[model samples]
Target: MVAAAEVVACNEDLITLILLRLPVKSLLRFKCVSKKWLCLISTPNFSSRHRRLASASILLSQIPGLISHLSLNCSSSEKPFSSLDFIDDSAGVKLLQSINGLALGCSFHKLGKPRSYYVCNPSTRQFLTLPPPNAEGHDSFATVLGVYLAFDPSKSPHYQVVCVRNCSLSAAHDRYQIQIYPSETRTWRLCGSPFASPSDIMFETGVLWNGAIHWISPTGATLCFNINQEHLGSMPSPPSDEHWSKRRFRYFGESGGHLHLVEIYGPSTTQFQVFELERDYSRWICKYQIDISPIVDAFPEMVRDYLHPHHHDSLFYAFVLLFVQETEEGSSLLLHIPGKLISYNLRNKSFKEICDSGPKSTKTNTALHIGCFHAHQFIETLASV
Candidate 1:
C-alpha cells in the first residue's frame, strides 16, 4: 500500500486527487499536519470535490430533520456514507459564532481575558484561533455579536468574518459598521463608516442568514448587516401584535433556504413563535410571525422562565423552557439525515440542513452565542440571477 505521507509529500497533482477522495474529516485533521497541506485543502479544486462528495452523501440519506455537523476523513479511499460518529462535540463547546461551515467556539482562557471566538469548520473540525479585535483606548460598541463570515473559493480561498460595531452617539444607519478578519492576510479591517442602527439593541439578538447577518434592534426592526457591501439595512417588520417584542431574537436559524426566528412569550401562559423571512423581500415587505405557539398546555412538563430575552432566532426546540409554575423537561430536536450546511434561500423560502447532530442530540444554548458573517461577493449574483 502507498504511504499516505508520501502521497501528500511527493506530487501536488496526486495530492489534490487523493485528498479530495479522503473523508472530509481527515482533511480537517490534516490542516495541522503542515502549512502545505493547509494551503492545498484551501484551494478551489479540493473544496469543489469536497462539496461534490458531501452532496452525494446527502442524497443517499433521506432524513430531513438533521443537519450535518461533522464530516470527517475516515478512510484513505472515500466512498458511500456509513453510520459513523467521528467526533462527539458537546454543547459545552461554547459555540460563539458560526458562518458558512465554520464555527467560532470559546473555551476557558487564562490571563483574565474573556474567552474568544475561534474560526472552525465543524464538519471538518478544522479551526483557527482569532485574537480579539483591538478596541483599546476606544470605547466598545454598545452591543456586539459575531456576524457574517464569507469566503471566495476562487480568490485565494480567504474568508472574512464580520463583527458588528455599534458605536455610541452615531446617527448613520451604519452606526453598526463591520470589522473583518481575513484568513489569507490574517488581519482585521474595519469596513466603511457606521451604517444606520439603533443606539441600543436591548441585548445582542442576531443570526447569520442568506449570506448576511441579522439582529433585532431595540428600535423594533430586524436590522440586516449586508456581508457584501458591509451596509446596514432593515428587514420586513414583524406582524402587528401589540404584545410582541422584537427583543426576543434568540432563535435565529436558516432552514430550507428561509431565515427562521423564534420568539418566547413571557406571560402567564408560555408561547413560542416561529417566523420566516418574507419570500419576496425585494422591497423588504417580507415579515415573520407566529407559526407554532402556546406549548404550555401540550408541554406542561417543560418549565422555562424565559424572562431574560436572548437572541432567539433559531429552529432548536429541544431546550426546555421553565415556567414559574411548572418543572423542566427535555424537548425534542429536528432530525434530518446526512445534513449539509447550506445557505438560506430567501427567495425559495428555504434553508439547507445537513445530516449530522441527529434528533437524539442534547439541546444547545448556541442560539444566544451565534455571531455573524457577510455573504461572499460571488453569491451576490443571486440578486441579479
Candidate 2:
C-alpha cells in the first residue's frame, strides 16, 4: 500500500503478466498510460503470447457487405459491435473468409481499377492489401470461384491465400484449379494441375478446419485441400437422402476445433440434425437434433403463410443460421430472422434475442437463401500480415 506508481515500477515483470491476460480492447486503451508500458505491449513476443491465450468471438454478417462481432460471454443487452470503419472504403468491402484472427476481404471494382483483396486483423485494426492472383490467361475463360484464407497461429505466424477458379472448358467439362499465396513468399503460385469437380459443388462457401480448406458439395461429396501438403483429397459427407434432390445446407463451419455440418431436407420443417466430423475424418456422427419448434411457436412469422400440402418448402426462407458456438456451458445456434438475431441453446432448449438486426444501411433487400448469412470466428490477436 506504499503507492500505485511505486508498485508498477517495482514489479515490471508482474505487470507484463497481467497485461497479457486482459482483452485487446483494454490493452489498446492502456497503451497511453506510460512510455515504458507502450514499449512492452508492442513487442512481437507479447503479441504472440496474447494471441495464443485470447478467447474467440463470432463475426457475423447477414449480407456479405456488413460484419458485426458477437461476444459469446456477453449478456443480451450488450449489442454486437457492427462496423467496418477501419477500412477506408467500407461500403465496397465484402468479407470473403476468415481464418484464426485474420479476415480475407475483397473490395468491389471501383472506377477503372480491378478488384483488390486484403488480409486484415479486426482486433488490431490493421490490414495488408494483397496483389492480384497470377492467373494470366484464364481470366477470360475461367470464372473466379472463391478465395480462401488458411492460417494457424499456434503453428506459425504467417498465413496463405488460396484462389480457386472454375475453368470448365465446355458444357461437358467441369474443371478447377487452385493457386496459393504464402505470406512469407508474397507471390501466388499454381498448387497443382487442374482437377475435376462436380458442377454443383459450391466452392465459394468453403471453411478452414484442421489445417485444410473444406468445401461441402450439395451432391453428397466433400472436397478438401491440404494447405501444407498441397494435395487434393475428399472427405466423407453427412448421410444424404436419395429422394430429396434439393437438400439445403444450413451451416458448414468449425468451432472449438470441431467441424459441423447441418442440412435441412424438408423446407417446411423446423427440425434438423447437426453432424460433426470425427477427428480421423472417417464419418460424420449425428451430434445434435435441433428443434426450433418453440422459437418458431413464439415467433409465428418464421413460417410463411402460403398454405399448401404439396408445397413442402413453405418455411425454407424464414431464417438463416449465422453461427454454431461451442462453449464450456454448452453450444448454441445463432440465427437471423427478418429483423432480429436470436440464440437458441442446444442443451437447454431455451431461446433469447441477443440483439436486433443491425443498421438499415447494412441490410439487404434480397430474400433469404442458403449461404446468405455467414458467421466466422474472430479470435483477438495482434499478429500483423
Please report the candidate that would top TM-score against the real structure.
2
lDDT of candidate 1 at residue 371, scale 0 to 100: 19
RMSD of 2: 3.5
Model 2: per-residue lDDT, tens digit, 1-385?
5697788776988898999988777888888988988999988889888887876667766554777666655634333235444767644777777777788887766665567778887767788877767665655213678888888877888889998886666759878889888999998888899899877788888878888889877777778998999999989868867787765787888888889889887667788988999988998999899988888878776777456646655544478888888877789998877656788998888988764444353245324454556777777777787
Candidate 1 segments whose C-alpha is farther than 4 A from its true place: 1-22, 26-43, 55-93, 107-111, 122-126, 134-136, 139-147, 152-156, 166-177, 244-250, 264-273, 279-300, 303-385
- List clashing residue pairs in candidate 2: none
**Per-candidate TM-score against the hidden true structure:** 0.54, 0.87
lDDT of 1 by residue, 159-189 (tens): 7767765554534443555688777667678
Return the lDDT, model 1, position 175: 50
TM-score of 1: 0.54
Ten-residue segment with the worst summed lDDT in candidate 1?
Answer: 376-385
Residue 58 displacement in candidate 1 (angstroms): 13
